[model samples]
Target: MKKNTIVTTDTIAAISTAQGEGAIGIVRLSGNKAYQIFREIFSPSKPIKKYQSHRLYQGSVMNGANTSSLDQVMIAFMKAGKTYTGEEMVEIYTHGGSNVINSVLQRVLKAGARLADRGEFTRRAFLNGKMDLLQAEAVLDLIRADTDAARVQAIKQISGVLSEFISSIKKKLVQVKTNIEVLIDFPEEEASPKQLFDLKFILQAAHDEVMHVLKSYDQAKIIREGVHVVLIGRPNAGKSSLFNAIVGENRAIVTPHPGTTRDYIEEAINYKGVKLVFTDTAGIRSSEEPIEKLGMEMTRSRVEKSDIVIIVTDPSAASRYDEELSIAKEHKDNVIIAINKVDIASKDQIEQAKNAFEDYSVFPVSAKTREGVESLVQGISGPSLAPSIENAPVINRYRHKQALEHIELSLNAAINLIDQQAFPEIVAEEVDSALAGLKELTGEVTSQDILDKIFAEFCIGK
Candidate 1:
């Protein structure tokens, strides 16, 4: 793979804080000329020949003409090799008005600092060996995390827990590859039974570890990216009422009329530290109206893409029981049957509804009264839908998961080759391939295009 070379010759500046009014905003600069640019634009309250590193000074940012002060600010100078990007850095803190922040940034730019690119600061940290690619991604995850579970996972990754694990796996693969190379070099020497057993044992251990990590990807994905749930049923089935009950707000319109919801209404909630996005789609029914037909089409598409499908039905809709059951059958793998309006339904009706959906997990709930709604919520947030793996590091990104899968495949090939007593050269090649995948996962070797794509997702000021 071709590695991208990083250059830190010019100073880069950007507004570090979020846009808009606040108590304070920061303008950050990093590179060889960071301090030089700072000196030109700032006039300290107390005149000093040399500035102290890592110390904040009261100063006023000078205007472009150097005729007057633009804003009163506190500036800090951090010497190279100890800052976030491992280069000389400067941060100017000013009053957080949009105009003031913009003026300060423009002054720094006029002093010979180029505007920083998206995630360029963090990318510099990665290239400077301050942190690995996994930690850099964790920084982004932590910034965007909306749930406590996601925040904890990002913290673990940023602390190097996942990097250490990947490194340990790579170390094992390298050792096994070294042993295989020795065998290949000395073809005249016959391999001992003990040596072959040891090789197979180590390879198997690595393969099993990869499998275990791969299993956590689903749970990690749910925590990082909120779950997608779609409520579906025939018209006048109380789907809208149940949606409001679950969201604890009147987000969806509810009327006695059928097909009230012509499109989907979505709302998100945090329950037990997991983000659940519930989409209330239009009711599914045979309709001659063009708009209703379009709404039904959108409902089918959402159901197909949802992580969980709640098939809502009530005793009042007993006549359409077959239609609801057919919909459930289509998504049997992730379908949950909810019997809504139990408060109004007679005991016999509730019992019959349960018996009809006996093959699946059924919850009898009164959306109007919120009776048994907690049980339904529990069922939706159950371990089957989102497993708890808090103690270990998880691979949340698709890139990481795909890389681990390739590593697993390569290790399996090596193990099979060993069992067949294949040539040492062939086994060594497989081991090398697996090691390369591990390297790619931690970014020891990666193409420039991949790096560009990963960093492009970040905001410009990041």
Candidate 2:
């Protein structure tokens, strides 16, 4: 595998748009041969001597001679030093169809353009100094985001909001290191109390800021990867009904029989811009039947993985749901007591449900009528949902958290050394370690393995 793509002069091509039929599809190529390949295959309507940079030209993709026409396309030529890969680039917008785009890509490849690897386009951009590691990851995040909130976070990261924050902290750390070095150079000039106090303050501030960002990882992950919500209750407790109501579709079967739904079903719903992946599990019950017993086991497994468990209940006989309630109790922190089928129940039954799970936040909902379901959804997705995009540095990646952890530890060590009045040399070393971590965060120093792992998450077209 190539260590870096910066020095390579190979021209790479790929079908840069989604597969299947649409109004338009893009075949993209980058590197030295991009323009050469484009000119060779593309026959413009008007004869032109030289293709200008950043201009779109109407043309036909010719197979070999003028008589053999492939497809009508608009070819864009972007000059080197002003393109995405820091190399010459070409984009062919053809009629959107799998065969059409594939044919164009093959022609570009046959014209000496190599097939781009997964995320090779973005990878080249990163390697060529177009964007840093965090910004490059944002490109993938923006593509994968399922909700508006997640998209906003990704956009902020791409726009360098998070990078700027990290750079600020890094700058301060560098200044602290320089101060320590100055003290180390003159051992005769003992560091004053004021100078030591100043160093301590700076280190503490950086440590606190790191913690602030670290603490947001859970919330960010919930947004980036939608929250897993499981609807669990006893057999015939209306779990499927509630699931259908929330998903706004007839996804799971609804029946009078208790064990009709023997397996789990999942669907995603956007509640106030937050994506909630609600899974309707097999009704939890003590059944002697083999299939039903197997289903109960799956319910338990889903409960363990869920971020929120909505304990669906029949208000008419809420007391009969003790076993399901107990499961909710085990994960009580994330449990939502939803007393379902409220329309048929008496006032006494609703009161009984309230008393039974009074410790949990109980909501009376009628899935068939779609009452109180909206509020329930808001409650489940609200707390962790980011209030706005202005909170830009929401640390979505575990890699970013890991890098911050290393920097935190180094800052902590530096603080301890300063407190003990240890030699400034030792403190400077710890500070340098922290600086190295910052460099790693932004791709100033990255291994081929790391780059491959990050970019491999992208699809080939990216």
Candidate 3:
């Protein structure tokens, strides 16, 4: 369908609750004929001779022919222009149960209502001027938020903080573009030096705004998708012990024998309202055993995907994990050196371990005694826990990031043309391209395929 196409011609119905037992289940309908279709199957306790908007009545849902009741329900009606979809809507509140909800839904379908597609309700809201693309995307983010920090970012996006910021930038660009077009329309007029300077200034400001939003995608990604942390070290380096301590459980088996852990163990924990998924991989070693070799390969793959690598070191075998240390050093920003078993290590042994990895920040920790474990967790999530993040506009999706890049590119081209003293018409062309990028970001410029991919991410009945 086209971006502006209104989708309220046919009434749509769906079970708006989870597919299990609960306190209540809601069956929602929206379209021009919603009230008419709902009245066909719902019988009110007191006669509802006249249809009223925003009124609830006790009723029972009946079969298509209105002969037998299927379930007890309380039905509500909302007239057009004030509903979620900006069309007539009705909602049926029935007892929570799969059978009861399905039966009532079947009756509604049989009474000329079609089952709703995934995210059709919210899509309608966007098409009806209720919310923009940014807010619509936030609904899914809010639903899938795994931590308090992620929830805060999602709520800010949904509240139009990012949208309003982008709007302000776009409004300034529009004014600049209009003045340039006016100059182009009258070729006899030579643009003044002051006009050229002002144009350059506006373009630079827009470019800076786009770059500012782009800078936050990395931090937002960590909040939206939890950070992946992997514990890697040589055999019997206390990798398993540190993993268990961090997760607050004995999730991995502890053993004195080297190569006891032949596979990787994964667990997630919320640290300072941010999520950290820790994985305990097989200890890195020069083992020729087939199982140990295969486990090492998997460990390498996990390390490549992980956002943080905790290279645990045992003071007794200080020089044994040089190969693992080399690997961690390759990703300097993502590596955290942890000296485990510090409770038993002597002063010389601790000094030797720290000196071995002097290039990296090393933390002396004892997983068994829980010493310095909290500091390790904090070190793993560097800069993300800063309080300044609360006030920044976070771009949580790749879609938004790409749109900002487009705007930046367009503004750069326009600014270059202004510097070269190019024709006003050519400069206006670049401005128009930048304006289109903003429109696409806010759903003003979109296609059917784009709409389908975005809404498909949402759960049904949203």
Candidate 4:
């Protein structure tokens, strides 16, 4: 949040690789003089005259002005029409080092091209109609995705699954809307109620599809953020150990002590290609520590809003009712029971803990022995994984959601007007609004300003 990434039109150039030494670093140029700059700085392995588009040229890049050799490198010359900026583009691959990459990039900039806007290469792709607004946003989401579930969802989105779904809906709505307008256009020649039933049928069909998709939205958002899961139980119930096991990191301080973790600790888990965040909250017990008291209050609130809650308890603790139990009941649908220290407890004791939380999927896990941990992870991550369908569409961005809702409202208005047998113009207006919403989603109705805003969020060297 402290860093401000910039985008501009002065013809950008930047080191397009991660910071640090690597096998190779790429210095990229995108703008009018991209090819010209390459020709000036890079001499191709097979030197002729003209530069070709999309061809990798093995060559030596030298600073003609400084009379210095840069590296035995590769040059990718992209012509204007097909390049990232709708201008010529070039990438110089050189030995990975701060001095070499920086020197090459500075030479490119000095020759002509400017520093790239944070994600300018991609921004130009968006500008050139290579991808939609949703897809562009998905690229960022995919880069930011920290879990398997999230990555899968973001991949689905970036791959155009969600866009295709929305497009299909839009197509159907357009047809329905067109039919209604036609009926209004030819009022005297219109079909009777029996035939009007056809229009109604179409409306119902479109609505059904839209709502069916909307049903998955809550889960999609949850997956994108990696479901917030809170652990609650009485003191010394192996909650911290279980938390460490799931995250594969000793995030919470574990001890024989009852109140080792007085606050929440979070870590990421890759469950079934889905990402989940395990939050080990404070132990629920009678405690005089003001901080512990505050932690309990926080844990209670976290339980309220969490996507999943794992109640870790022993038979003795599970048998008794407390603050955590009340929260577990309120969020019973999202709660899972973890009978901890099963290595020490009998089957009867584990069963008793399971019975106490009959509403949840209970598992007996011994953190020390790493038993039943996989099943618990599976339970949490299963719901978030990508659906088996090829090209699963995930609507993970707020912008996509907003556009969909707008489209929905417009379609609803059109549908209602059709039902009331209103004038065609009113219904047509609604259809136009719906079409506008769809256009906005795909960048067909966007401006350069919006494009700048979107690309500016990317890392400077991306």
Candidate 5:
């Protein structure tokens, strides 16, 4: 990995838009010299001595030597303190052909502007206090979000919902710490019963809020990164057919012959704003053939890593019912039984199959006729598997979750000490530690290395 050299004072320029052919491409520059650089390269349709801030002007970009025009364009100049980076910024819009975009960027670079590093633009925005670290991370999340839920969550974070909530928690901790510190200074004064009760109440409330946010991490994980649902069962159990039915396309090869699927086939579908990646793996069964055995091994491996494992079976495979049920039991916590071929099976067979997996959630469906497939889809992301992620603020990043866990531990220690009527100094120390965790979470006391790693995940020019 290359190191990022971030010098906010220096004039930086880059192609902000993705590199490709499109209707328009943007070359962005930010710093003290942004306006000066723009003046050197841009020739407006009408001559003007001064450019108005936040106004787009039709123009033509000049070549590096300023002897010929490179491309017809539109330019916008934003004044410092009101721009995304809180610095004077300029954007040149040109035709999105590779040549035109590159030429425009090179011209800006030649005009005393250093090339912008990956995520340097947003990094500047963070350093300038236009947005907090959580919002900065959300910007990246928004760009990479593939589902509606992820996008909405990212938008909420970017709007400072999570930051404000954490800030409020920190404020409460600070108040408790201040009270303890005052008591420590005046050792002659005794804490009244009501005072002790109030302090404990605040601490307990803060702890509960932290735990609530922590519980949401699992659901946030599902929202930000979709769950992997793997299909597993013996050959001729209709695993491939079920896979095709759920994905609403013939993504996998379905045949009457056993072991038709030699490898896994995967397809993704967005259901209820959550992405579900379904993998139809080779049948799990005892086999002497080397290739079939390898495929079976892969199936078991997928089952272990999957977020949800669907065990496909049919009444015709009665002899292997126990064998398949045994495999499902290994991951019974996340396993869902899908009794396929129910369209032709007798009612007793379906009832018997359902009774066999009474311990797990079972859905009887015929892939050929598409019966009960929707119910099976709904079951994949049911409340037992994924928590409700409607509008509630959640900590999606591991960084935030780890900080919250540390804060919880500190709060727990403080609460215990307070209950025991320990020395004010010791209790204050624990509360202070929890406060530090909050600072770290909101980037009030973040390390340079951590900031680099966070922003490095962004693409160039973001």
Candidate 6:
């Protein structure tokens, strides 16, 4: 960015309300010329000639040319340093309509403020230091959150969970930095075998802490967004029925014939504060039909890529599941054997399924009747689930994970160097690398292009 272009061309204005009819619509403004334009035409309900920051007044928005009253409204003024952006701000809360609110915004624009760029308001907030980079990312997550679990994770980030974690790592990094400086500055006095041995202890503890956080990342990632569960099995195995039951909606078609669901159907659900992205993929089988073959190949891909795989099987055709169950056992870290159509099966047939898939966690449930179905969800992610994600590190974005991974590698390298009694200079390089990652996470050492990319994803009036 050019030095001259840093502050933007002029004062800006925008319609903050979602474009539609509502009880109220807000026209927001920010910049040096904000109040000057307001004073020229606003006829305050009381004390019309003067205004103060944060004071609300009843008023009528008028076109300066004709003095025509556009709408009845209440205006709220915010002083610099106290508003969303650290600039003078004005909000005109008019009765909502496409015509009146937009007309009022245009009038403000004519008075001199330009229309706001996408996320410019919040961008200004970041420029003014009201919030850090992580919190700004949370703003988007909170807006697009599909489940309560996602919202909760976003709120944790906004409330500084990630910040605190970064701080903890930074504290360790600071100690490592101090040790390196001590060795470099006074090699004769400070660089001794005893000092090196103590430094090893410090590096080991820091490395362990990083590993602990890394171990919990899987749980955190799932809770922050949702676990991707892909259902793949032979057709007529009640796969769609299981999806509908779990989603509590008829999200997928179910019929007595094979290959009824030709593609995948997705649905979101919060299973006790843990969101689940349940997908019903096409049945995995060879077919003469091109679309079905493509779908079957896609199902295989989804099953391989997903965090969890659920294979639905019918008790009547339990013979096919012997091989399927073996595969599930091989990938036991994320596999659930779901035996559907239990309502139609006899007690002996249900028992046979349980015995056949003994190596995997098999659940016998009737998705059509919603009987014993809730248990399957509860087992994977629910209140009764053994592991809880309370205070889990909220690293949902790939950028954050990459940064943390750098920290992990650097810290581990430092630990190895310390163990091997490698030179302090080599250890210092690893420390510096770790510090760079932590700084990037808080955006202390980030490039303008990255910041632009981050904020550019936001909508206008953020």
lDDT of 3 by residue, 1-462 (tens): 123555557889999898999989999998887888887898877776796779888978988564888888999999877777777889999999999999999988898899999999888888877778888899888888888888888888888888888788889999998899889888798999999999999889889988998998888888888899999988889999999999999999999998889899999998888889999999688789899899999998999999888888899666545675678669897788999999988888999888888888899999999999999898887667752446667687888889888889989999999999999988888888888888888787788899899999888788
Model 3 gets an lDDT of 0.86
For candidate 3, list the clashing residue pairs, or say none: none
Local distance difference test values of all predictions, in order: 0.87, 0.87, 0.86, 0.75, 0.87, 0.79
Reference-based TM-score of each model: 0.92, 0.91, 0.89, 0.82, 0.87, 0.87
Local error of candidate 6 at 452, Å? 4.2
lDDT ranking from best to worst? 1, 5, 2, 3, 6, 4
Candidate 6 per-residue lDDT over residues 299-414, each given as its tens digit: 87777778888878888766546667666876787888888888889888888888888877888888889887898987667532433547756577878878888888998898
Clashing pairs in 6: none
TM-score, cand. 6: 0.87
RMSD of 4: 4.9
Candidate 4's residue-wise lDDT over 102-189, tens digit each? 8888888888887776987777666665667787777887787776656766777777876787688678767867776677778888
In model 6, where do residues sit more than 4 Å from their true spots? 1-12, 110-118, 146-149, 186-190, 326-330, 383-394
Model 3: weakest 10-residue lDDT segment is 1-10
lDDT by residue for model 1 over 1-462, one digit each (tens)?
Answer: 122356566888999999989999999999999999888899999888889999999989999555799899999999997889888999999999989999999999999999999998988887777888888888899888888888888888999877888898998998998898889889899678799899999999999999999988878888887788899987888999999999999999999998899999989888888888899989688888999999989998898878899999888558347887887888887899889998888888888888888889999999999999989888887863444646676899999999999999999999999999999899998999999999898888878888788788777766
lDDT, model 2, position 118: 95
| Candidate 1 lDDT trough over 10 residues, lowest sum | 1-10
* Model 6 deviation from native, Cα RMSD in Å: 3.5
Two-way TM-score contest, 2 vs 6, winner: 2
Report how far residue 405 has shifted in candidate 1, in Å.
1.4
What does the lDDT read for residue 296 in candidate 1?
89
lDDT of 5 by residue, 260-370 (tens): 998898898888777888999997878899999899888878877788999898975563478867877788788899999999988888888988888989999999999
Cα displacement (angstroms), candidate 1, residue 13, comes to 2.4
